[model samples]
Target: MTDAHEDHWAAPVAAAALDARVRVPGSKSITNRAYVLAALAGAPTRVRVPLDSRDTRLMLGALASLGARSEETADGFLVHPLGAGGSSHGEPVEVTLGNAGTVARFTPALAALGDSPVLFDGDEAIRRRPIGPLLTALRRLGVRIDDGAGPGRGAPPFTVHGDGGVRGGTVELDSSASSQFLSALLLAGPAFDRGVTVRLVGDAPPSEPHIAMTLDMLHRFGATVEREGAEFHVAPAKLSCPEYVVEPDLSTAAPFVAAAVAAGGTVRVTGWPSTTTQPGDWLRGFLPALGASVRLDEDGLVVTGGSSIPGVDLDLHEVGELTPVVAALLCFADGPSVISGVAHLRGHETDRITALATELSALGADVAETDDGLRITPAPLHGGVFHTYDDHRLVMAAAVLGLRVPGIYVENPATVGKTFPAFVETWTGMLGTGR
Candidate 1:
């Protein structure tokens, strides 16, 4: 566990080549999705080896608020489904979303199935992220919502009044800002009176893999979802999963994989799934363009550093969450790199593109923010403070930069607890720097 009082972390520099094996925990995405599905299931579901990070803890609390209790077992959690019509005892409920986007977006529609009022609020950053589009769609589906931000300008600190059911039907949504907007409705669709059909009205949402993941999980839980181009139709069905085993989080494995590229050596991540809907799986294809040899075998995904790191042009709109760590790796490239099609990242935990540009430039890299992405040019970098902007991915990026750049201090390293509580220990241990 990271010390809560520690303000800054002296990121360790690799003294020699690294040849290490790392075992990452369960996926935050899968863990939270399992929590939601279990809560909506017909019976108790066992979520085995779920991620026990802050985001998942918040999801557990959110489910508890909705009257879906859970019991901790020796290996995982056994979740009880919410009662029929998802009704809580006729009293008002308050949910704390914290800074988890999964909780902020996914819980509202779940709350709409109840017969009481559920108040949704979050941290300061959540108040700035986009939630208006989903709220509007929910309202169109006849779910009563009280958000002071009128029309298309909704944020946190809102109330949902559920009259025991949702009159769900076809609704148009502009999910370009975040794919979660579409997923939020789909997850809760099966419980709706008429189910839900979502049509994409604007730019296609980033993170297409997440939507696929949602559909896959929905199917696993007995819900039938249909897809036609940019539209999705989810049919009403009872959800039930006797057991769900979460896979390792590939996104969290990014920085560790980049460590091989930054400090010449080899790194292997165990339990790499043969098939996954995770956007992080895209790393296997793109890392080679940066002069890294990546191979997936029976052992796992192994990455070996190349003699030289070359830059390449790439579009990452479909996998925007990988931007921070990829951007950090590019800072050490032999040539300039252009990462395009991820403008939606601005609406994330923080303005990730702007934060990356600012912090990378602070460390002497020539980073310029483009309309949709970033242009990073290699430069003589020195050690400096890398502010994380309360985003966990940013911490991983800082750790990658610290591999070669000495004196790279990370601010509020504890923020990584949002997804990986053992990030510091695991990272330092890989370099033989941990106690």
Candidate 2:
């Protein structure tokens, strides 16, 4: 969920002999963004090898609810975009985005073009994430939006009532917080009457590559967008048929590589391209820095760990999601590792940096939290039950930690459903009874 509020359970997982050739999920980032753009374009598009996760599925369901159609085909999916008349039936379209931030933001923006108001709602966690920035952006577009419960409205069950007044205008947003604000505007460009221009009013953004990904998708949709530093320009453009395959997920594969080095085993992960648009692919570089004897072949990756690996000092702004997984690996090395460049992580599923430091320290590793990152001192970890903050990354990081120090228990093990649901079963497939 978005807000780190209310009740949640931790997942318990102990380290096991990890010797699996793991094939992780497709890219969730690419899948969700494309789904919104394709559906709004109202054109038939094919997304190959897409990630079938909770977030992406919520976006897909929103598309269908808005009159778009999707079908399972081959190993991917075929989407048929609907016209303006599709959701004009005057029925309230209820969409439960279930903690998927992409759909929660972009869908309401896209639905503003229809005659019906897109009533957006989500899970308890989604209910907590703030949408003031996006709501401000939409209202600036001349779309009628009721952004709050006001005296009576508060959380989920919020509504975006469209005035059908799509304007091409400039929205000044603070991207230092989230690229989702900019991405939402880009996805809504084709439907806006006056085109759109977004001016970022903060630092160079946390996930720069994700913004690049959004721009690339905009270009693919036949939208005319101009880039001038932090300001992006977009005009009403045609979204022609899109032919694309979803890239493999390097983020999901990071933990396995971490385990390979932590447990003194040799393991390989497949299905990643040597080249990728995802900055998370930088895992190859980061892992090696943590002392995992890493080899990147044209096909995939091979990692061998066990010896004394030195700690690393690094900035991971571009690949923040990989930090927790890599941090667990660093804990097994010889010295302290300092990682910076991810202040925005405090807003993720959990305050990732703080939560990681707490969990790692609880396991007897020396770690300290910072405003923007984490500092870790290498220490032998005696096995203990890990309280996963219901974060998939934490769950994975805990698993990697357990591999190095036995007797690890994970709470809320199901949190991996966001990316890798069959984690224990599928990943354990490789570490069979052999070693």
Candidate 3:
């Protein structure tokens, strides 16, 4: 394996069946939430084992822009809050999200607590992502938000005008576009004068597990949360910052686990939580259904790939982020596979549904774009350049496909820095190709 250049990667071939133990970094979702909650807390908070990546760093930077101070420790971060009624009474702060959906969605509501206007924007991809639901919800809670790009364009390049703080109460919105909308609102809800009561009045949001994760983190920080089905009531409470530990990212572990299943070997990732809200743990069932033997022993969750891969229908609404890895595995399966209930994937880092279809078809696989998901039929796949669309999931999925198909070059391989910065190093090392 060699670097053709900075932007391109000549994906390595597996010398043998992959038999190695790999450890992924901390969870991006958890780390971002910790940063948001810590900044809003009334006291100093210590975030332990937080993921150090582009997305988390962007969240930290956004918090710093809002007058929250953060210090880097060897293990993670030490965050000093700006009290309950935090405000930055200076010039408008510029927040660059860098194509991070979590940073873009969650920060706006938090920024509304500042004394000055906070201008929020990001990369080209971020401009295309939908921030309307969150922005509308913020407005309903009495925060002044101006969509600089204008109405109908429900994306970013906007500003949140803060008059010291917000008057939060009951809010209703349809979060089917993305669950991050609801999570974003709830994270910043506790700091408001009357707190927040959110009601889901339309189609149930996809990725329900992520909302559950948000609620769990809020409760961990001592916020009082009452849930009755689609309604959530959070009383006005002060969060006393406590030391927090982040778990390893199960979403980042998806590709590595997929590699083991596709290449015929056993792979175990350390630090699999015994109990957690991460939806990616659904891999425990998805992997086995795809012809892998999955077990949780002392080492961690281990998966051994079988000789034949099977195709099955799956509804990934609860765990949509795992779709790319599942799509990659199905490319080599014996029959057609249908993945449903993931229409929300259209607004991800890229239009993942179309991107996966385009890239997989580029490799000679028969892929059909469904209304809510994808249908893949096993076909003869040959080496081709897999376009990643600057998405971390696509980068990992293409790399997993490279384990079986030779000469697959991945475009913009460094896009993995958004989440797993050491993805290439860890992936190659697991296949015994390290320096």
TM-score of each: 0.97, 0.90, 0.96
Per-residue CA lDDT of candidate 1, range 361-407, in tens?
Answer: 99999999999999999999998889999999999999999999988
In candidate 2, position 428 carries an lDDT of 55
Which numbered prediction scores highest in lDDT against the true structure? 1
**In candidate 2, what are the lDDT values of residues 49-149, reduced to their tens digit?**
88997777788888887777788788777887755325556667777788777777778876676667777787777766656666776676777776465
Poorest lDDT segment (10 consecutive residues) of candidate 3: 82-91
Residue clash pairs of candidate 1: none
TM-score, cand. 3: 0.96
Per-residue lDDT, model 2, residue 167, is: 79
Q: Is candidate 2 or candidate 3 better by TM-score?
A: 3
Better of 1 and 2 by lDDT: 1
Give the Cα error of residue 308 in candidate 3, in Å.
0.9
lDDT of each: 0.91, 0.75, 0.88
> What would the C-alpha RMSD of candidate 1 be, to one decimal place?
2.1
